[model samples]
Target: MSAPGEKAASELPQRLWLNGRVLEGRKDFERALENASEQERPVLEFGLRWCSDEPEMVLHTSGSTGRPKEIRAKKICMAASARMTVRRLGLRAGDTALLCLPMDYIAGQMVVVRSMLAGLRLVARRPSRRPFEDLARAPDFAALVPLQVLSTLEHEAERSLLAATREVLIGGAAVDRALAARLASFPNRLWSSYGMTETLSHIALRPLSGPRAGVWYEPLEGVRVSSSPRGTLAVSAPAVGVSLIETNDLVVFEPGSDRFRVLGRTDNVIDSGGIKVPAEALEELIGTVLESPFAIAPLPDPELGNSVAIVVEGTPDLPLPDFRALLRGAGLSPYWKPRSAVFVERLPRTRTGKLDRTALREAARSAPGRFRRAL
Candidate 1:
């Protein structure tokens, strides 16, 4: 419980709303702690710093781009993001929102922050076998990742829950053509947002509706976007904490517009026989050809410093010659295409549902003769 004087009206209480019933955070925490302790040690153990931190959120990068670094976003930034969202979506003070993502991440944290700031009721649920089962009634707003949306869409009742929401914010990873196509059929307002933990969540939102169903990054009032020498995206927003966050994300600016298309990460670039190859670009190419979830990465090579390899989760039996021909059809340079293709039952992912590059690299190395021949 917050100290008597410490409790502010703005402070989000634990038991805000659960289905139709309201549960208090402190009482719920005590019960949950007891229940969890009986079965095992705490699923999440936090430090004193986290408990006492004035900021509502402290998010860390997944280290996919580089080493995982801690980011401290003041509650003010969260409030600012909420305020922008409120204006953009025309949400009212008494509306409701359902939260499914983990609070440890920005997506979930923002829901709590927005609920507090807007004086809106928040419905909380433990991510379950069927997450929507916990929702007492339909909510006015909610945020979901691609995975959750796909999973919920597979079930009639779950899909009903999704359809009931007035607005749905989707992020965390790229939404493919298949998912996008399905979402297009729904009448609900689905927004594909772009942001990172450093940005205190999304600063740009594109409608996932008819005609406007493509990438559009409209910077918030306090935010700015620019490019670097390497054609990478750079973000400047007071709400982002840093003056300028130079990202490794590759982007191409539209000729007459501020919107840009995110190509992929600059760090994923590979050198094949003296040719510089962007692995992300190759992934896009392969995805276009194969129409499947695939990733292209660099394999250590003595001759070229780094050679290209392809990993696919589908159809291991697909012949290498046919796959090569697909790349050729796509007009990709020979060196930019994978030297070897390895089929895995499924690509391993992290807890946060991101590709585990370290695991992928190790998997590539362990494949017989693949890494050696690349070298």
Candidate 2:
């Protein structure tokens, strides 16, 4: 609809996969960059790369584990991944989608790519801890980090607006039990996605609410999951060009089942004498009783090779003995209970929201006495 003397709206450029800007040439893309906001520039740059004649573009891995690296990603493979999501989610033309994650990452780039391919109307917003404080409309779809969801749930109007979202995807980090408990009966279809940078986006999704909630992540269409000799996850999905990529995550796979549960990262396993203790498992146990931001990490021991220690962001409500008693009450194996506790101002996190274990371990090792004490 147009007012008198107003020109009709032009169709979005299919080649550049854009709706707002006219990108008829490289010059137009460059011009958009000059006028774009800091938050908007990342995706606009990505859009320019897509518009270029080159078949491949560089994408940086989310350095949650280690250093970030740039890898050449194919547009064809990216489109295939987008199409797979379209089919899996049953998205249709003109559906409204909220794009909030940083466009520099695959998750954010895929939002734009998917919306372009599926003809979904995109509403782009800057990434924030509170995702929808400003947006007025209830989008049909949205992808958000757990922190954003948690913040949104704290507000009545925000929660209601979020509840109206038809398809909600949570990722960028593991959704903890506490967060999952809050979303157990969300009005819409909520899923916790699992994937990495190399996979383009999620290859599996865990149901977070409804009757199907609380299960292992089921593989997406065209995805095959297996295990390596060391119990690490192996994925094969040619549609996204991933072939038998052995992940560092250790898992338990059923003999003939497609669903698998991730236990922990092999690198995080701590060996004390002959006993192997998984830090992730210990962290889960501690999470059961401790509400504050905390982690289970291995602290070097002169007697044993390493000992399990609790690293918390701040002081807990109860004293050390009470906390230890709480751990004992949780039925945490006597041998597995953290022998000590370390307090820090805050836990370090990677750009993509994963815990910065290397940084935390370094800090703990450097100043064990400054913040750590026997529990």
- Residues 264-324 of candidate 1 have per-residue lDDT tens digits of 7766777677898877676655555464555776777788877788876655555434555
- Return the TM-score for candidate 2, rounded to 2 decimals: 0.89
Q: Write candidate 2's Cα lDDT for 1-375 as tens digits.
A: 433442222222343434354344457768878877766677677777776667666788887778889988677778778888888888998788888888878888889888867878777777887878977878988999887898899899889989999999899888877788889888798999989889999999998988988848888999999989999999999877787799998988756888987888999888876678888877765666667788777888988889887788775433443545655787765677677888888888876667888887876777546566786
- Estimate the TM-score of every prediction: 0.80, 0.89
Model 2 scores a C-alpha lDDT of 0.78
Clashing pairs in 1: 14-25, 15-23, 15-24, 15-25
lDDT of 1: 0.66
